[model samples]
Target: MTGMRILAVAGGYPGWRAQALRALAAGWPPDAVTWTESDALPASAAGQMTLDYAPAPPAQTCAVAEPAAPVPAAPVRISRDFAALLQHAALYRSTQRWALLYRALWRWQNGDRSVASAADHDGARLHAMAKAVRRARHDMIAYVRFQQRAGGGMPEYLAWYEPGHDVLASAAEHFARRMGKSSWWIGTPHGSALWDGQAMHLSGLPADPAAMPATADQVEPLWLAYYQSIFNPARLNEAALVQHMPVRFWKGLPEGPLIPAMIAQARAGARRVGQAAAVGEMPGKPVPMEAGRAQPPRALPSTLDQCRRCELWRHATQAVPGCGPQGARIMLVGEQPGDQEDLAGQPFIGPAGQVLDDALRRAELARETVYLTNAVKHFKWVARGKRRMHKTPGQREVEACAAWLEEEIARVKPRVIVALGATALRAVLRRAAALQDHLDAPVLRGDALVMATYHPSYALRVQGVRTPAQVAAHIAETLARARQLAEATLPA
Candidate 1:
C-alpha cells in the first residue's frame, strides 16, 4: 500500500481485458493493484492515467506505473463460456465488480475450480450479474421502438431508451441486422448508439434522453389499430404485463398510452369477459347454436358462404352450395366437396364428381333430376407440397355443418337421401355411426330414407380396397336404390 499503482482503463470490455491480462502477466496479485476508469489513458496498464468516472474507486496515483513485471505468471486459462460470461458481467455498474471479477479469476487460475461453479459464493455472484446483464440486453432489444423521421443529417429512424444496464452498444447490433441497412439512433441517459448503415458509433452519456428529437412513426396509427384489434380483453393479465414490461419503459412506447385505457375497459364488468372492444363493435349475428333459441333461420343457400358456424369456411374458396333442381325426390349428399368443387364453387365436380356423374348416368338417373350436395360444403384440406390433400373434417366441423345439411333435405323434399360417406352419415342422422355399419343399409330420418355408402373419392385413393370400377358400381347401385325407394314411397 506504500507505493501501489492504480491501473486506469478507458472503459468498456477492451479496456478492462487489457488491464486484467497485464495484471495477471505481471504476477501482481489482485490485492496488489487497483482499477479505475480514465479519460486520460496512459500508454499501457504500466503507465500513469487520470481517473475519469470508472464507477469504481477514485485513483490515488501521481504519474506511477502499476508494478514491475516480476517474470510473467503462467498463462491462466478459462472456459470459452466463462470468458464470455466475464465480458457480460463486466458491464454491470457496481463499484466492487472489478475486485469481484479479479478474485474469481485468481481463484479459478489457482486450481480452485469451484470459483467457476454457481454453487460457490463468488461463482454465484458472477453468474447472477451476467444473467442480469443478458436480461437487460434482451429488454433493450425487445422494447426499443424506432420511429422513422424526415431526413436532415438525422438517421432514417430514431428512438429513446433507458435500459437498467449498459447494454445499448451490444443491443444496437440486433436492430442493424433486422432493419437491414437502415440508419438509426438510440439515445439513453447513460449512453447513445447510432448505426450509419455500414457501421455503428457508440458514445458515453447523452445530454438528455428527453432531448432526443424525432417524429412519431407514420405507420403508428395503423399499428395501434392492429394492436387494438388483437388485444383480447378476456385474456388480459395486468400483473404479467407489468412484470414483463416495466412501467419505467411505458413512457417510451408508442402504444403505452393505449394499454392502460384498454386494460381499464377490460376490467369493467361484462367487458372483461369478451373479445377485443373493437371486434365486439363489429356487425355480425351470433351463429345460431340452439334451434329453439335462435332467430328464424336465414335462407340457407343465400347465407351458407357467410357461415361462421365453423372455422372451416376460412380456408375454403367459397361454400360449395347444393346444386341441381330443387324439389327433386332424391338428394345425394356426399362428404365435403373435393378440390375442384371447392375452387369451382360447385358440388360434385372433381374426380370424385366425375365418378358420381358416370354413376348417376348408369343408374338411369339424370344429374338435373336429383339434388346433389355435400354434408360439409367447405373443402377441408392440408397442404402437401403444392397440392391440398384432403383432411377429414373433425367432429366439431361435421356438427357445425349439420344445420345446413338438414335445411338442404327439407328444401329438396328428398324421399331418399344418400349419405355418400361417414361424414354424410354423421351430418344427416346427427349421430356417430361408422360408414361400414350403415353402408348398403337405409335408415329413416323424418320423411327421408337416408342411405350410406363409400364416397366417390374412396376410389381415387391410391391402392384402395375398392377399385375405380367397383366404386362407380357401388355409387350407381346406391343411386338406383334411392330412386327405387323414392318411387315406392309414394306421397299420402
Candidate 2:
C-alpha cells in the first residue's frame, strides 16, 4: 500500500504548535512526505490536499478554504484539565462559537469521522465538556487553600488560589488591593502572582506546603460546633451543599471537619423546630384570636418614647413611636429605623422616609393624614467602627416586638394599611409572599386593604443600578396604584 500522505497543520507559532503537529505526526508514517510552510509538492498531489492561508490583514479574521482531500480525523483525549480549558474558552465566546470550538476539538481527537460528526454525539459531547469544565473550575476555586507567608510586611495575611480562567483575576486583584495593605500572593497552577502594597510580582506555582496559623488558637472546632448547632436539617440540599461548599472548600473551612456532623445536627435542629411548633413553643408562632376582638397589648404605655423589649433599643439612638390622628384613613408600615430615624426617634425623618415622602407627594397622598410607624419598634444594626449599619430583623426579632405593633394598630385603627416589604407584610398580613410579585397587589386583612410595595430603601438602591429609571418609574407606578386602590376601597 502506498504510504498514506499526511500533512501537519497549525494556527501559528513553533513551540506552541509543536504538540498538535507531533500528535498528528504520530498517527502517520514519518516518510509519508513531510511538508513545511514553504515546501511545495507536485501539482496533482498539492491539489488533493489544501491548506488555506489568507493574507494577514490589519484587522483580525480567520477564513477557511475548501480542501480537495478528506481530512483524516486526529485522535485526542478529553482529560479533566481540557474540560476546564473548554469552559474558560466558552466565557470569551458565544454559545454557538463555543459549540463550534468543542466540535472542532472533539472531531480532531476522535479518529472516527462518522462518530465525531454525528449531530447527537457532537452536541452531547460539547454540553458535557462545557459542564464538566464549569464544575471543575468552580470546585478548584471554592476549595483551594492559601498560606500566610513570612517576609511579606504590612499585609496582615496572605493566601494563594489558582483560577481556571483569567475572568476572576481582575476581581481577585481588586479584592487583594482593597482588603490587604500588606503583601499577598495568589498562586494559580499556570503561574503565581503577588501583590505588595505598591507593586505586583509574578512567579511559578509554589510548592505545596502545609500551612497553619502560628498561634495555638485554632477556632475551627468552636466554629464547627456553632455551625453544626445552627444547621437546619430541613434545608439540607446535598446537591446544593456540594455545589456551594464543594469538598475542595472543606480544607480551608475552619469547621470543615464538622460538615457531616453539622448536617446531621441541622436535621435534628429542624426536627426540634418542628416539634416546638407542634407543641406551641416555637418563636414567632401566630397567636390565635377570636374574630372582631382587637388583640391589644395587655399593658399599654402612656408614651412609646421608651420601650426596651429587645437589644435593638440599646443601639437604635431612640424609639420612633406611631404618629398621626387616632382614626386616620391610612396606616403606612415601614421596615425599621434608619440612622437618622434612630437618632430622631421618628419614622419618616431619614433619607429613606424622604424618598417615601416624595413618592407619596407624587401620588397625591397627604403624608400628615397617614399614620406612620415601623413593624419593628426597635432598631437592629451592626456598628461599623463608628457608623451603625441597619440590619434586617429576623422573624423572632419582629415577633418579639409584635406587642408594640399590635398596640399601634389597635390605637390607630386605619382603614387601609400598606405593607412595605417582607418585614412589614409579615407584620400586617401574618404571611409573606415574594415582594416583587405582590408589589401592587392588595392583600385583604379583614375589611382593610393591605398593599405591598418595595421599600423606599429598595427603590433608592435600585436607582443606582442599570434599570434606575425603570425602577424609579415602578416605584411611582406602584405607589400610585396603592393610592388608587386605597381610594377605591375607602367608602366615600
Candidate 3:
C-alpha cells in the first residue's frame, strides 16, 4: 500500500456501506484505506475499488466477528453501540465522515475501548454528528404533515419533508409503525419512502416538491385553529420555538406560515386587554348603574364559579375569589392564583402568601385589614410531565377578569390600593406601564391612591438588594407607607 487504496460504495444505504467498511477495515490497515461515497468520487478515479456491497446482517449475527486473528495480535472488537453510532454518523453530509469513522474503528481494534467517550476528540466529533442525525430524524417525524389525497379505496396520504441529514430511510420505520393501516408516502429532497400498510420501500431518486398535490386537507383549518388557541402570548419565546422546529422545515409545515401573524395578533391582543381594562368596558358587559340595583357583594363568591370570561377556567380546579372583609380599608392585589391557591380555592395561601403574611406581621398590619385578591382569578398553566408549570396570564385574560376586580373595588372602596406586581399594576392602571416607574412614589388613579410594590413572590426571588431580613424590612416600609396613605385619604 504505497499510496492510499481508495474504496467507494454506492450511497443512500448506511447498512450497505457499513458492511463494505467493516470488510475493508478487517483486512487492510485503516491508514491505507480511503473510503468515499460513490456519488462523491470524481469521474477520473476509475481505478479505485468499487466494492460490491450488501446490507449488513441482523444485529445479533453481526454483533462480533473475530476472523483468524490478524498478524498484529490486536483483534477488531466491535460492540452494538459502536456499530450503531458509526452507522448514524455515516449519514452526516460531511466529506471527511468516512475517514473519521475508519480512524475511530482502527482505535477500537488497537485496544482503545474508550474511543467513544466524549473526552476523546474523535468521540466528541462522532457524538455531535450522531446528534445531528438523530435531530434530523426527529424533525422528519414531527413536522411531516400528511395530506390526505382524494381517492376512493385505501385512502392514500402524501407528505413532503426536507431533512438536513440522510435520515429518510432511517426514519421510515417510525412512519410505517405509526400509520400501520394507512398507505402513505413521505418524500424528501434526497429520497422518498412509501409504506403500503405492510411493507416499506425506499428510493434514492430525489422528490420534486412541485409534483406533490397543493390541495389542503379538510382538517387543516381545525388544526390551525387549535394551534392558534394554545399559543400563549405571555410565554412566547421565539428563539426556543425556532430551535426545536428549525425555520428550514417551515415550508412543509401547515402551521409555519401562520406563526408570524399569530405572534403579531398575540401582541396586539395583549395591548387591547390592557386598554380594555383601563376603560370601563372590560368583560364586555354594560355596568348597571341604578341605585340599590347592584348584586349583593356577598353573592360574588358563588357567582365566580360560573365565570367563563377566559380560557383559564377550562384548566383551573376552581376560581379562587378574593378573601377578605367587604369593607376593608386596604386592598392588596396580586397577579394570579398559583398551583396551591388554585387547588385550595383560596387566595394568598401559597408560599408567596406565607411571605405576605410574614411581611404583614412585621409591618404591624393585620391580614384581616386588607382585601387580598389577584388580577386574574383563575390559574393559567401548562403541564410539564407530572407537574403543572405556571404560565403568566396574557393581557386578554386580565381584561376578561377585570369586571370581577372592578366589582371588588366598588364593594370595598379601599382608600389605598396596593398593586403587588406588574400584572396587578396593569389591572389597576388599565394600561401597560412599568412597575419601576411607580415604585418610588404613589400615583392617584381616580378616587384611589394607587401604590406599586414588589409582589411577595418577587421579594422571595430577590437574590441581591439585601438579605431575607432586608426583604422583610423593605416590605414593612412599603406597607407602613400604604397604611399612612390609607388613613390620610379616608373621608378626609
Cα lDDT for residue 287, model 3?
A: 75
lDDT of 1: 0.77
Give lDDT: candidate 1, residue 125: 94
* Tens-digit per-residue lDDT, 358-392, candidate 3: 88887789998899999999999999999988888
In the predicted model 2, the residue pairs found to clash are 74-108, 76-109, 143-248, 143-249, 154-182, 155-182, 233-266, 233-267
The clash tally of candidate 3 reads 1
lDDT of each residue in 1-492, candidate 2, tens digit only: 222332332321232134333423333322232333323334564444433222222211212222233444543565565444444444332224322443445345654444332255554555555555566555555455444545434344555454444333433455565656666556555455566667766553342433313223233334443464355565578789887776765755566777877667656665565455446634675667875565445554455643544566555555777788788767888888777766555687777887788878887788887898888887788879998888999887787678788777877776678877679888887656677666766766776777777677876676344464565556566667766665675644
Tell me the whole-model lDDT of each prediction, alpha carbons only: 0.77, 0.58, 0.77
Per-candidate count of clashing residue pairs (backbone under 3 Å): 0, 8, 1
lDDT score at residue 27, model 2, on the 0-100 scale: 36
Residue 102 of model 3 has an lDDT of: 75
RMSD (CA, angstroms), candidate 2: 20.5
Model 1 CA deviation exceeding 4 Å by range: 3-5, 39-72, 151-153, 210-212, 270-272, 275-492
